[model samples]
Target: MCGIVGAVAQRNIVSILVEGLRRLEYRGYDSCGVAVLADGMPKRARSVARVADLDAQVHETKLDGATGIAHTRWATHGAPVTDNAHPIFSRDTVALVHNGIIENYESLREMLRGKGYEFVSQTDTEVVTHLIHSLYAGDLFAAVREAVKQLHGAFAIAVLHKDQPHTVVGARQGSPLVVGLGDGENFLASDALALAGSTERFIFLEEGDVCELSLDGVKITGRDGQAAEREVRNVVAYGGAVELGPYRHFMQKEIFEQPRAISDTIPATEAFDPSIFGEGAGAVFGEIDSLLILACGTSYYSGLTAKYWLESIAKIPTQVEIASEYRYRDSVPNPKSLVVVISQSGETADTLAALKHAQDLGHRHTLSVCNVGTSAMVRLTGLSFLTRAGREIGVASTKAFTTQLVALFVLAATLGKQRGHLDAAQEANYIKQLRHLPAALNSVLALEPQIIAWSEEFSRKENALFLGRGMHYPIALEGALKLKEISYIHAEAYPAGELKHGPLALVTEAMPVVTVAPNDALLEKLKSNIQEVRARGGELYVFADADTKIVNDEGLHVIRMPEHYGLLSPILHVVPLQLLAYHTACARGTDVDKPRNLAKSVTVE
Candidate 1:
């Protein structure tokens, strides 16, 4: 994924571009660059290092301009080199920063070559920049409009032309783009978070929308080159989500904040209200008989955990899919099924595309469980359950995952009531437990010291296996994912019942098989699975129920979960594992928040 920020103001915008790029750094970038229109030319500085390095370059060169476009690249078209960084030029008159792929760039590049245009970088972005410049007869806007017509794939682009010194042009087809409204200035960025401190007013660009940002205001043009009126609304952002106040890493802070985060995610009500999801949520739940969840990475595991709740509590047949695979594969879609999309940013490329793909197949009843209300997922869905996880800065996704589980469980229980599966007393009991979840999480947070002690052993291990049964199987998968992502360890998860069939072969004395043992009906089966691992000379690190009979002996190390929450057990069990991964990653001296090759949000496919 890449981050783009553009601004046109009366004052020099180099600092604004740099500050915006810093805000977008959590999205992840390897190289950064900026191009500003000053003295009737585009003054540009690029660096293969961090944004701060780019800022240093700007300071050294004294780059000054009123209109500028900056980019933080993840390096799609070429290697992570200075030349491959963005602000690829078009004859010094046109400079542009682009996110997403241009599928027909080779053909376009050859066509540009026919017109005697030469390229300096091996980037598809460069070809488009050159193409736009070549088409510039008099107006930059018209040239950009013509150039975009020749493009073939997804893009969110911000272009700066010397001819239009007071304007920055932005175009989006299949990527996230938004315009920030400010006094005597206008801004464009791949995300609204980049414009957080500057302005709260945002204009979310729709698909195939193009906009021109000037010092005065913004002008929009639709895909057909016709004028369009776009509404600008105030969308407040999570204040200081990137700041690691008093915590070593965001993962650690987020792990500790689980109690408050869960409390915020779950409403403080004596009884569960179906309307908590939104107006007519009960009606939507009443109509849908089945569930299909589309998500990726940790969000997929959240959906997997929800499957257990939806089937057991709501009696709805449910299936979960990795969003990337879901869009490409042919599958039967149920008209009455609720297609749920889970994402924190709500801008995940695969999930967004899959959400649309599901809709294309006549699954119109769509719901999204997301954190960002201004995200594409929420905008595209018919219903939404917005989590109060705030902005999850950690690339490993700690609080977001748990909060997602909370939202999903709420959906399940609400559906259960609507389906007549949960009686009035049962619903009241679950609601009481839900209201008490924050305190339960607080009790579990106290187990962090024990988790930290267990993490010391994990830091030394090269490989590990996480095992769980029933609903906790997804928790096992998520646990292994967190460890592998942050600790740089090779880890895998298996449903405990599948152990003797295959995964047991890798269970050795050196391999630590972490288990999530909740006091559900499957606990006996999970205990049997643990015995099998122990019989094979495998060391076991388990987060078990407080009253579980399994004791710490020989090679078995146990970290007791404070309680066993029936439907919401996964949310509570995940916190200790998060603490485990964070502390282990710290012990291993790995980047606990910005893990290598991992972006906080996957905005590109």
Candidate 2:
């Protein structure tokens, strides 16, 4: 996904737009561009690399204007080149910055070419500009609406017209768009993070909603030209403390901040009272026959962990599916089913699509556990639980996954209590354990140096195997994903008991086998799996709890984590794996923060 930002102001706005682009650079950094309305026409400055390159060019040849749009692209439809950058202009009149994919752009481009609409860039976004120019009828908003009507797929567009220099129009279908309120100025961005420095009040535009913004105010309207009303929400700004502090990168800072994030997420009895689930939640759990957990990427691992919790702890039949594949499948959910979608950026494209599909299939009860408050998934779901992970910057997801598990654990506990599967003592005990997770995580983080040393061995390895069982199986999957995502290592996760099925054949002295052997009900079986690897001469790196009597033998690398409550061990076990992945990537000299061809958020399908 790309990032889009636009500002309509009474004063010169180029600096503000560039600053907004800088704030949004975490969303994407492949290329950056800006278009400003100047002298009754649109002027552009763009580059194929970092924003600093474009900033240098802009400084040399200033394009002063009061209204403009900017974009930092992640390059979906075309190659990452200067010509393919955003701020795609239409015959030097209107400029557009788009943040999503245009699925029908190839056909639309052919038709537009036949109609004598010349294009310069090989991007789906360029087609939008040409389509708008071909359909202009004195109203840029109307032309944009009509242009989008003829197209298909996800997009959040910010269009500026040279003829109407004082105004900017924005619309969204499947991607995220938020309008920020400012004094004698207004802002448009793909997410709240881009506007956090300028505004706290925002309007979250829904699907098919169009908004025209000017220095005076903003007007909301629908695709059919009828006026629409939108709710203004207050966003808490991340102040100066938002910097990386003493850490080298945001990823490292985030990894170390997990303890604090966990502390903030787990609520006390007075704050998050158990009685809150006494209403419709109880009724829903009692009446619901089955459960479906839908998610993508790291969130999918969270859903898998939730499936184990729901099935074993709450005694509910649960199914976990990758959101992209779930929507296209032929299976039908029962009418009494509860669908739960977990996401950090709740705007994840596939997850949102799956949630919509479930709604369309007549699933009346749905819930979203997400981090963002006004994301599409949260707005569409019947209920939502916001995870207080606070702006995860790493593409591999460290804090968000743990927070999602915390939220899912809470949900599981609620359902278990409702169905009489958990008594008051058990519920209270789990809640109390949840409260101590932050401190336990703090203890686990102290082992980062040890894990980093272990990572040095992994740099020479070509492949690795991650093993766990039950709830820890999801942690194994997440660990493998993190390692593969940052280090380019070929890694796979298998349930400890399923090792003999097929994966055991891959074990060798050259391969490193990572086993999650935290003390649990299945620890003995996990030990057997480790023995199987050891017998095969596979180098073993075991993350074990301190009290667990796991012997340190030859060819075994052991890192002892502080003994945490069994239910909270997953949260602690993930820290060392994160460190291991980080150090492995560092040793291999890969881009740890911004991985190759991967954006932080998947805002496009």
Candidate 3:
């Protein structure tokens, strides 16, 4: 995924374009660039640095215009360098920025090259710019529409022209695009966050919609080439949601926000309501004989953890599948199955496709645990639990992962009660645990100093191994994912019992073995597994609960959590791993929030 922002306003929009790019930096930040129609011609500046660097370059070049477009490229086509940056120009007439992949760019580029249109960059977007410029007959919007008609694959593009000084055009086929309404000004971006300061009212463009923006007004065209019905709605963003007031990175701030996020996602459990999933959750649970969880990335690990809860607590046969593979594979779908999809953004492409796949296979009941209530997943699913982890800006998820786990646990408890596995007293006890979760999370956060000390040593290691059992095994997977994703380290997680099979051969004095040691039934077996690591001269980092006997010793490090609730320990154990990853990436001088070649949302397949 990449971010694109365009503005056609009365005053100079250089500052607005820069600010919009900054807000959308979460989508993509490998490289950034801006193009504006200055005086009578389009002026462009691009860099492989952060948005701040691009803003400085624009000021240095004195690039200003009433109509402008900006982009942050995630670089799927070429290297993340200035040459591969967006806002690529076609002659002196057209400038363009794009957000999605063009599957047929090679043929388009060859066709344009034969037409004598010189190419400057190795990007699919450059192909679009050249194609649109080749078709230009004095009308920018019409040229863009004509060019898009010959394209294949998903894209959301914003175009600015030197000739059309007061106009900006945007078209979307698959990726997200929205138009912001202002007084005598109009804005467009791939996300609503980019328009936070400009307008409260927005038009969320439908699939295959194109819009022409100018200071006068906006004209939207549907895929059928007819005037489209536009509905404007006021979106309420959380107060101070995107600010990083006192944190080192957005990832660090989100790690600390877990306490509030977990509390808000589950709320007070005194009432012990089954409507936690939705108003119709009880009926859905009553009819389903099995559960299938479809998710991707960190959300997939949450689904993996939920498999243990659903089987042990609810006593239901459960299966977890990666959404992308599930969509392509021919899997037998049970008619009485409740298919659950988990995503933080609620716009994950593969997960949405998998949900449709299950629906098409005659599985009628669908549910989603999502953060954004306005997301397509929530709209398509029959039931949803909206996690209140507002505006997760970090690409490697922190609060959203834990919040999904919280919501899933609630769903598990509701299912258990529905199936006569949990009595009223047992459900109330679980509710009590849920109510006390926030304070427990606060206590667990106090272990950050100890985790930081571990991270100092962890930064020196090139490789790490995480081990756990049962539900905590998925937490181990998420832990290793967070470390390798942002820290640029090679890490892997395995089931503790599987250590003797193959992974033990790779352990050495240079390797640090991280273990998630919750005091569950497998603690003794996991202790034996830890001894196997220490016996091989591998340093150990153990995250254990308060009641466990794990103590710090030579080659063994233990950080005790406040208290552990059975079936809920995975949520607490994951917090320290997130902090460890964030601090280790910081110590190693790596980009913690925008890691190389990674974007926040995967809105494309």
Candidate 4:
């Protein structure tokens, strides 16, 4: 995934474009580039560094224009280099910025080369500029439509032509592209955050939709050249919502926001109304004999947590599959199987593909648990549950993962009740506990200062180990992922009970061992695991509940969490680990929001 931003008829728009790029940088930031139409030609500046470097160069050179397109690349077809950055130009006429992969770029490149078009950068995006220049007939929109027709695979493209300085044309298929409406100017960005300061009114382009933008307005059309009407949506602005809000990094803020996110995710009583599930979900769930959970990354871990919940609470045999690997496997799902897909973006490529594959295999009872309402996964699935985590900008997921877990837990409980596996008292208890999660999360949020202090020790640590038991094991894996993603720390997660089997030998004083030891059935075993590490001279950091009876003596650093969370301990236990990763990244002086070589969405397989 890469970030694309375009503005038409905007004066001194370089700064605005750069700001938009900064906001969208979470999408991709391997390199940055901007193209401005000046003096009847496209003036392009690009660098293989952070956006700030390119912004400085543009300011120092006084690159000025009204209409422009900028991109922060996450290399796909080529390595990160100045020449490989976007907005790729063609003979001073057209400039293009692309966000998705072009599977048939080699064939297209060969055809273009046969037409005497010489390429500069080894990027599939560069092919678009050349193709547009070759087919230019004074109609930029028509040329874009023609160029897109020749391409294959997922892409969200923004094109700017020197001849049509006041116009910017874009097309989307299998990638996110939003149109932001403004006065005397309009915006095109991969996400709404890019245009947050400029406009709140947006139009989320559907697949196969094409649009042309100018200072006046946006014109919509379809791939078949037919006029298309788009729905204008009023996006609720979460102004400064990305800010830490008294926390450290957005990760830490998001970690603490999980409790509220879970509370928000609890299905309304109206959802239990017979009219909502239609003739009751009993008939639909009754026919299901098995369950499949498909997801990727941290969402995959949430699915794993859900598998345990559904198997234990609902008595439904469940399987958790990583979406990328799921689709390529020969596994077969029966007609009585209920396929559940989990995704934060809901646009995650592999997860969406897995959903499609399951649907193709004739499983119509597919359900999607997603954060975004209009996501591709939502559109494709027959049934859906929405998690209201708002917007997650940090590349490493925090609120989204916890919200997904909450949604899945609710689903599992609902299924248990419908299947006669859970009694009224059990369901009521779960709902009551769910209601108190937000407040319990607030208690965990209070641990931020202590976690930040712990980060100082991590700064000197070259490697770290995360240990947990039962449901907390997945959380431990997630914590390790966060540390490695943002802080570049070599961290690994191991089941506390399995440490003695192999990983215990790797423990040393130089390595910090973070343990998730809530008051669960496995607490005693986890305590012994902690002692095993401490005896090996390894530094110990424990995130335990208040009544867990864990001692804080001798190389043991304990951050007491709220006591007696029961099954909801996973939701609370992840907070300190999230803060640890966030503060550690900050201590390491890493880009806390936009991690290196990572994109917000994996739109490509």
Candidate 5:
């Protein structure tokens, strides 16, 4: 995934483009470039550095123009070098910036080469710039429209032509693209975060929609080449959400925001109701006999945790699958199964594709648990539960994962009530537990000082292990994921019962084992698993409930949780692990927010 911003305005657009790239830097930050049409020619600046360095270059050279397009790239087809950066030019007449992959670029490159066009960089986007230049006949809009018809994969592109000054053309196929409205200017960006203070109104383009932006107005065309009207809604940008207030990293800030986020996600309700999902959710819930959860990355772990809740509390059979793998394998599709998709951005490409695949297989009862309300997953699903987590900017998710768990717990309780598995009194008890989550989260966050000391030890190690049982196994997996994501450490998680079978062979005095020990039904079995590791001389670091009676001794380190939350311990236990990862990354002097080889959003398959 890459970030793109384009502007056609009455004033110089250099500052606006630079600021937009800074806000959109979370999408990609491998290399950045900007192209502006000035003095009847295209002036360009490129950098194989961060956005701040590129901004400095732009200002030092006094790059100015009324029309321009900028890009921050996460390289897919080529190395993260200056030549492979976006704002690629063609015949010195046109420049373009692109987001998704062009699957048919090889054939297009050969065709363009036969037409006497020489390629300079190793990128799929260069072929698009050449193709657009080849089709230009004094009309940039018509050229973009005709050129997109030859593409074979996902793409969101913004183009600027020297001949068409004060104009910018953009198109989208499978990636996200939005048009921003202003008084005497218009903007195009892959995300609305780029246009935060510039415009509050945005038009989210549909699949295969091409848009033209000018100082006068905007024009959009549908896939059939006919004029189309998409609603322009007022979107509140993440002005204060992106700021790093008093925390050293966004991950730290997000870890502390969990209490507020959980409180916002679970409504101030006295009783359980399916209507919290959306209108007609009760009908959908009544029609389903099973659930199939599709998700990727951290969202997948949250789904794994929800399966335990759905089966135990709701008395429903549930299956969880990795979204990227679900579409490639064939399975018996049950029409009565409710397909649930979970995502932080709600624009995850693999999850969206899996949702469509499920719909094609006659699974009509669909739902989404997501953070963004204006995302494609929300629009495509019949019902949705919006996680009020605000904007999550950390590459490794913290608040979004916990909020998803809260939303899914609400779903499980609602289904339990619908199936008669829970009576009125039981339902009220579940509500009481959900209401106390905010205070419980605050309690977990207070253990950061203890975890910071543990992080110092972890920073000196090259590998680690995580252990849990029952529903907490998924939380262990998430903890391992967070550690590996930011700290550059190799970590693995195993169900405590499964450790003796194979993983116990790796246990040694040099290895650190982190365990999640809640006082649940599996605690006794987990204690034996802990003895298995300790007997092998592996140092143990345990996060246990105060009532578990687990104490620290020689070779055993324990940090007591404030209380043990039955069936809801995963949400509280995950907060300390996030803190461990963040502080460990800080101790190692790594980039805690933007990890290498990873972007915040996965917009391409």
Candidate 6:
């Protein structure tokens, strides 16, 4: 998942491009570069370092221009070195930056090489630059148009011609690209956050759309080779500046923001409405007898948690699919099943493609639980509930995960009411529980000091195991993910029942076993599983409800939760695990926010 920022303005835009890259840093990148059309030539500085380092190079070289393109590259086709950094030039005429994969680059590279074009970098993106340069006959737009026709795979590209100053051409195919509107200027970026501070008006380009940005105006051409009309909507930007405030890291700050995030996602009012999803969502809910949830990464875990909520509370048969594998395998499709896709960015490539695949199979009932209202997933789905988690800067999601659970719980309650499983009084009690969530989350945050103490031991461990029974099993998986993502520890999760089967073989005194113990129906079975772990001399760190009766003893660590939140215990139990991962990563001296070999948004397959 790379980032692209381009601007054509009357004033010098080098600083603007660099600042835009800074905003998109949360998306994750290993290399960065800026190419500007200075003095009628393409001049660029590349770095396999942070954006700040690239900015320093730009300033040291005095690389300023009125029109430019910038990129933050997350290596996919090549090593994240200066040679493979984006803004790859061809014949010194075209400077191009691309996000996403190009599948047929091998053949194209060979063809271009036979035609006397030299490839300096090992990248699929370089093929496009050569193709554009080969097709260039003074019109950069037409060259880009023709070049894209012969290309395969998903990409968002921004190109600038050395001969064509005060203009930048951008195209998107199966990837996100937006145009920012400004007086006497126009902009292009892989995400709106890049242009947040510069402009308030944006045009989210459609798939296969090509945009031409000039000093005074912007033109859009659809895949049909005709001018297309796209809505220019006003949007208020958030998280344009990545301010940590009093927190040490973005991950820590986001963990503390969960209280406000959940409150914003669901209203405290006692009334429940299905129409919050969309205008026709009530009718859609009434028609569906089952649910099919699709997502990837942490969003997939959220979907798994919702499966428990939907089947128990809504009384609907539910199935959760890992989006990447769903489309590749044959599966049963029910027209009556409401297909729900969950994503924090709303632009996850696999999830979006899976939604489209579901539609192709005649599963017309679709809903999106996402954070970005303007994301393509929301636009493509029939119904949507936008989570107000703001911008999740950390690559490992915190507030987004809790807010998604809030939305899913709301959806489940609404479905339960529609199916006659819940009456007015029951719904009001659910509403009351939701009203107390923010305060409960605050109380959970209060346990951070204790969690930090637990993290000191976790930091020294090389491997760990997490366990949970029933609904909390997914929370265990999420906890394992958070630990491995940031702390670089090898961790795995198992349903407590499965521990005696295979995972028990890995347990030892050197192994740390983290258990999510809530006073639910599965408590007795979970306790039995804990005894098995303890018998194997496995160290135990349990986050138990206050009344679970689990306590600290020799070789046993227990951190009591605030209270057992009946249906909402998963939301409360996950907080300490998150803190555990954050603090452990801090202790291990690993990159907590931007972890190794990961990106915040999975824009490419």
Our model 1 lands, by Cα RMSD against the true structure, at: 1.5
Clashes of 1: 0
For candidate 2, write residues 1-605 as lDDT tens digits: 68888999988888877777777766646899999988888999999877778888788897778899999999887799889988898888889999889999999999999999888888999998899889988998788778888879999999988889898999999999999999999999887877777899999998888899999999988766689988999996562335887987788889988888877777556333334433366556667978899999999998888888888778889999999999899877677999999888888999999988998898888888888877878788777788889877777799998888888888777777777788878887887888878888888888888888888889888899999888889999999999999999999999989989999999999989998988888878888888888898988999988777886789888888888467667778888888899999989998888889888888888
The TM-scores, one per candidate, come to 0.97, 0.96, 0.94, 0.88, 0.98, 0.99
Off by over 4 Å in 5: none
* lDDT of all predictions: 0.89, 0.85, 0.88, 0.84, 0.93, 0.93
* Tens digits of lDDT, candidate 3, 432-474: 8887787888888898898999899999999999999999999
Full ranking by TM-score: 6, 5, 1, 2, 3, 4
Candidate 4 to truth, TM: 0.88
Best by TM-score: 6
lDDT of 4 by residue, 1-605 (tens): 68888998657788878888887765656899999999899998898888889889998999988999999888988899888999998987889999888888988889999999899888988887888888889998888888889889889999988888899999998788889999999989887777877888999888788899988999988867798887888886543535666865666666767777777887666233222222434666778888899999999988877887888888999989999998999987787888889888788888887888888888878788888886778767767788999877788999998888888888788788777888888878888888888888888788778998999999878899999999889989888988899899999999999988999989998889999988888888888898899999999999988888997888998988867788777878877788888888899999887787788878777
lDDT tens digits, residues 349-447, model 5? Answer: 899989999999999999999999989899999999999898787899999999999999999999999999989998888889998999999989999
Candidate 2, superposed: residue stretches over 4 Å from native: 239-241, 270-280
Evaluate residue 258 in candidate 2 and report its C-alpha lDDT on the 0 to 100 scale. Answer: 88
Of 5 and 6, the candidate ahead on lDDT is 6
- Candidate 3: what lDDT? 0.88
Candidate 5 vs. true structure, TM-score: 0.98
What stretches of model 1 exceed 4 Å from their correct place?
238-242
Better of 3 and 5 by TM-score: 5
Query: What is the alpha-carbon lDDT of model 2 when measured against the actual structure?
Result: 0.85
